[model samples]
Target: MLVSLFDQERSFTRGVDPMVLVSPSIDEEMRRKRVEEENRENNSVPLVEEEKCRLQTEILGVKCSLLRMERDIAVMRIERRVEMERTLKFIVQTYLLSLFD
Candidate 1:
């Protein structure tokens, strides 16, 4: 039975829906589009996750390199202090010897 498109009791599935009956081809097209959209989203999720993992790994590597650089800097400071002390001691001994002469 043909019913008005605005009828509330019309079921779209049973051809009694309020909306005009959609052609089967249009329905198939809509279904296909929905599936394609879902597939694209599903496919992209793994790529996004992989990108996140790669970025995290790169960040960790940078942190490790920075830590190593800081450690090296600390070691260099200690070495410089030791060298300065040795140099000061040598200069004092030279001054003492010259005074005796």
Candidate 2:
């Protein structure tokens, strides 16, 4: 009974799937969409390159700033060491003077 019903349905539909009829047009449309996407990518390539250059420049600027900050930190550290040594020396000299007195 199910086989008979399936045969009747197949006869009603003429045994042709709808996709089989429209597959060529679907394939052409897919190809056209791909070409459009490729064209879009090609057009945006220059913008991508410009953005890359801009980012590179920003990176260079950041690196320079980092180097400058590192130098400043080194100078500050040296100054701090000198100040600490002077303070220690001053304390030592005061203690020595009181001992002599």
Top-TM-score candidate index = 1
Candidate 2 global lDDT: 0.87
Give lDDT tens digits, candidate 1, residues 1-101. 33544454544456553445545687899999999999999999999999999999999999999999999999999999999999999999999999999
How many steric clashes between backbone atoms does each model show? 5, 0
By lDDT, who's the top model here?
A: 2
Q: How accurate locally, in lDDT, is each candidate? A: 0.86, 0.87
TM-score for each predicted model, relative to the true structure: 0.64, 0.52
User: Which residue pairs of candidate 1 clash?
Assistant: 5-18, 10-16, 10-17, 11-16, 11-17
Indicate the residue-level lDDT of 67 in model 2: 100
Q: In lDDT terms, how accurate is model 1?
A: 0.86
